[model samples]
Target: MRAQIGDRLVLEGTHLGDARRVGIVIAVAHDDGSPPYEVRWLDTGRATLIFPGPEARIESQPPVADVSGPA
Candidate 1:
């Protein structure tokens, strides 16, 4: 999987009743947007480098709408 900074990393639970973990990609290790991202978890507010497993997926940031009036 590939990701950019500000993208969210979602790790789905592997077993029943397991909680999902979500984090923001604070840093990318590779220029091509590969794994080994530095993530700051939303739940615990802790940062760590992680090589995401199969259960992990990247959630790209939505495009920001233009609040300014149309030209």
Candidate 2:
């Protein structure tokens, strides 16, 4: 899957009773928006680079203050 910076990543738990992890994509390593994203987790407020697994889902949002658009 492809994602941009500011996108939310939700990683599903592998087994029952496991809690899902949620993080926001802070940096996109590739220009094509591939894996190996830098994410700041919601729980710990720490950042890490991650290659998403099969259970990962991307939640995209609009860019804050589109600079080129009319005010």
Candidate 3:
């Protein structure tokens, strides 16, 4: 999955259930955009940072400063 910055990532609720979290992609690393992402997410308030896999489904827009581009 070619997840670009500014995209959103929903912590697969179908799998994680209540524990599921969701947030938007803030920053990318390696300048190559590889697995083990370094995302700045907002789990419904509390700002959280994680390094999920590339296969992690992206939302492209959740709730945060869109890192995609443009205003």
Candidate 4:
């Protein structure tokens, strides 16, 4: 899957009772946004380079809403 920096990498648990893992894409290895991303895991607060498997999916950053009043 493709991802950009700041996107979240969610690795779904393969077995029952296993917790899913989530991480942020701190770096992208390819210009086209392909995998082999450097992720900073939320739970462990550690970074690692990963060639994500089938269980992995990318969660893009949500759009930022304008907080300021309309001008």
What would you estimate as the lDDT of candidate 2? 0.95
| Candidate-wise lDDT, in order | 0.97, 0.95, 0.61, 0.96
TM-score of each: 0.86, 0.86, 0.51, 0.85
lDDT of candidate 2 over 5-45, digit per residue (tens): 99999999999998999999999989999999999999999
Q: Rank the candidates by lDDT, best first.
A: 1, 4, 2, 3
For model 4, how does the per-residue alpha-carbon lDDT over 1-71 read when each residue is reduced to its tens digit? 89999999999999999999999999999999997999999999999999999999999998778999899
Give me the runs in candidate 2 sitting further than 4 Å from their true place.
Answer: 65-71
- The CA root-mean-square deviation of candidate 1, after full C-alpha superposition on the true structure, stands at 2.1
Candidate that would win on lDDT: 1
**Local error of candidate 1 at residue 64 (angstroms):** 3.5
- Lowest lDDT 10-residue stretch of candidate 4: 62-71
Better of 2 and 4 by lDDT: 4
> What is the C-alpha lDDT profile of model 1 across 1-71, one tens digit per residue?
99999999999999999999999999999999998999999999999999999999999998778999889
lDDT of the structure predicted as candidate 4:
0.96
The per-residue C-alpha lDDT of model 1 at residue 20 equals 100
lDDT of 4 at 69: 82
Segments of candidate 1 deviating more than 4 angstroms: 63-71
* Number of colliding residue pairs in each model: 0, 0, 2, 0
